[model samples]
Target: MIREALRKLMEQAPLTREEARQVMTSIMEGQATPAQIGALLVALRMKGEAPEEVAGFAAAMREKATPVSCPEPERTVDIVGTGGDGKHTINISTLAALVVAGAGVPVAKHGNRSVSSKCGSADVLQALGVNLDLDARQLSRCLEAVGMAFLFAPKLHPAMKHAIGPRRELGVRTVFNILGPITNPAGVRRQLIGVFSRDLARLLARVLQQLGATHILLVHSDDGLDEISLAAPTYVVELKEGDIREYRIDARAFGLSPQPDGITGGDAETNAAIARRILEGEAHPAREVV
Candidate 1:
């Protein structure tokens, strides 16, 4: 069945949600060989997953994820993004998580270290003194105390550890990049996700629906940055009350000035410093980057 599924995907034929779910299950359960995994992921990349396929992949990820519970008034939202921006912008979503949590909505932000860029979300947060080594219970407690939680990606999805070599070997963007956002361990009902590409926003919103997310904002910054960008038109795929809405968000609507400047850093240290000044709410490019 796995071989046939791989063959089908290789042929660029879209899988039904069930078929894709089984493939994801097989992959996550160690049921597929390295060669088979390579074939499956490559086939997926070549064909590109449809919304249904994305939905199935998200379902299997959520099913296998180690669950973490949020406290009372379960209206929690995850501010996470797939961070291979290669643009080295400061941690926008992480900063947004802070403000969103401050605004009374419970937040659980999933993040990882710098892979493609100078400083990823976790890098900047760690620089700011957020203990990245918290256990699951500690993670929950942190959320209850501050209305926010940050689940380090590898810690929450240990299964992905085995795929690190495979993903790194592939080197460029693969199916795994998108999975990071869809597998938030917090089990929140709503989220704000930023995809690296505009085309991915719509596809991810559909997958979010299949994964049981009730309310979500899938976003792409028009200037190729993820998250909401002030300088460029923001592309969005919003899920509300079971309906999918796609539109552009200009900063003028929020009464904020728009400025998307070139964000280029030599390394993580440089980027982390930028994030520090921004989180301090000081005047800098990092503020706009957020």
Candidate 2:
């Protein structure tokens, strides 16, 4: 069945949602070989992922993800970005999650270690003394205690263990990259997702819409940064109540001035320091972008 799916993909034929779900199910169930999985991912990337394919994959992932409960799921939001921007900017989404939490919004930030950047959300969070090994119950407790919790992707989506080898070998974008943000373990209906590519911003919004997301903001900077950029205009696609809207936003609209310098790349510790400083009200234009 996996081989047949791969053949269809190689022939430039899109898979039905069920077929994509079955393929992902097999991969998660350890029924597919590493070689087959690698071939399937590469073929899909080359052909470009369809909305159905991404939505199907996300469905299967949600089925296997460890469930984290929220007392008020409707009010909770997840802030995540599909990495692989290769810009290695400071963890803007991570910092934004903290700010959102501080502003009285509950945050269920889903993240993983670095894939294409020097420091990922999980890395910087770990640096700040966040325990990434918490169980589902503990995660819920954290949310109740602090109005925020970080759901480490690897811990939440253990089924992804099967694809780690293939993803590492491919070393490029795949459907899984986008699926991460959409498959929040807490099943939060609200989200703010950042995409590495402009096209993906709309594509991801569509996928989230299909998944019955209540409210979502998909952002991609014109300069190619995944998060809303201070350096250039950012393209935004908002999904709300089954309606989709697209728009472009400039920094000045938010009372922010465009900074000429881009975010610098660094290891987890370095990025964590920057996040700490920003949260402490110390002024820095780069931190203001958060």
Candidate 3:
């Protein structure tokens, strides 16, 4: 059955929502071999995933993920970016998550270790003394105590381990890449998601809309930075109250200068330092990017 589905996907036919869900279920249940999983992922990437397929896959992941609850789900927000942007920026979204939390917004930040960059959200957070191995209860405590919690993707979605080896071996972006941002374990209704591509930005907005997301900002920069870019105009698709609006935002609109030269942190330690400087108002570029 899986082979026939893969053949159809390879033939450029999109999967029905049910077929996509079944495929992901098989992969997560360890029923699909590594070779079969790799082939299916590559085929889907090549053929381009439909929004239905992406939504179905995300539904399966959310079903399998360990849910973390907060006292106020509606008041909580998540800030995350699809990590394969290859920009190696100074972990802007993670910093933004911190700032948002500091301003008293409950934040359930979801992320993993580095995929295409020297530092990911988990990596930098760990460097800054965050314990990433908290259980669901501990995570809830963190949120209640500090107005923020980091839902490490691997910890929340243990079923993903079945595909990790295959995903690393394949070493390319798949539907799973986009799925991560949409599948917040805390099930946050409000989010700011940065995608590596403009197409992904539009597609994710639609997926979030279908998933009943209340307020979401899907952003992609013209220069390829995932988060709202200071270097270039950012294309934004906002999903609010079931209506989707597409627009572009420039840094100058916010009274900030365009920073075409990107910021870089060579490692997690450096990224942590950069984040601290931004928080302390010592780094202008890093502060502006956030």
Candidate 4:
């Protein structure tokens, strides 16, 4: 199956939805060898993944993840970024999740440890002593009680371990980075996704629309950060009520000055301190970015 798929991919032919789903299922079930997995990922990346392919891959991942019972899935939103921008900036999506939760919205933030960044959402959360090993039931409860839960990727998608070795050996961004933000364990329909590239912002919005997403906002900043940028205008692709629209927003609209240097981040400990200060109401540009 992988060989046939690889042949088509090598020919620059996109996989059908069913073909992509079957291929991803085989990988998750450990039927595909490491060499096949690496080849498939690279081929797909080289050809540029289509919406159908991403949706199919996300469907398989959702089917395999440990399911969490969200109280109101349509109202619940997951804020995540397809990392690997390599900007090493502060964790803005995670902070946005907290702010959204504070506004009384159910937020299930899905993320992993640092990958091509100085500090990831999971890394900063762990540094603050937040437990990353919660089961599905506990995660559900946390969402119900506090309106927020961090769905750690490895804990929710154990089958992903099969692909980790290949992904690490490759040492580059693959389809998994795109898959992570779309595969929320709780099955939330609403999302605010930050993509590393502008093309991905529109691509993912279309993918989520195909996946029957209720509402989603896909953002990419001109300054090369995945999250919305304070230094430059941010391109946005918003999917709502089944209509997808493209637009750009500036920080000045929100009465913010472009302080690009103010948003730089460091190691987990350093990001933790920045998070603490922002949460404590410190007047910093990172807070404005969030």
Winner on TM-score between 1 and 3 is 3
lDDT values of the candidates? 0.79, 0.89, 0.88, 0.91
lDDT by residue (87-197, candidate 1, tens digit) is 666677877788889889888888898777777778777877788888789988987998888888877777665567777778877878888888888777688888888
Q: Which scores better on lDDT, 1 or 3? A: 3
**Structure candidate 3, residue pairs in collision:** none
Would you estimate the TM-scores of all the predictions?
Answer: 0.92, 0.97, 0.96, 0.97
TM-score between candidate 2 and the true structure:
0.97
Top-lDDT structure, candidate number: 4
lDDT of 1: 0.79
- Candidate 4 stretches with Cα past 4 Å from truth are none
Residue 258 local lDDT, model 3: 68
Error of 1 at 106 (Å): 1.5
Model 3 agreement with the true structure over 47-90: per-residue lDDT tens digits: 98888889889888998999999878999999999978788888
**Residue 170 CA error for candidate 4 (Å)?**
0.7
Better of 1 and 2 by TM-score: 2
Residue pairs in candidate 4 whose N, alpha carbon or C atoms collide under 3 angstroms: none
> Candidate 2 — which residues are off by over 4 angstroms?
none
Q: What is the lDDT of candidate 4?
A: 0.91
Q: Output the worst ten-in-a-row residue range by lDDT, candidate 2.
A: 256-265
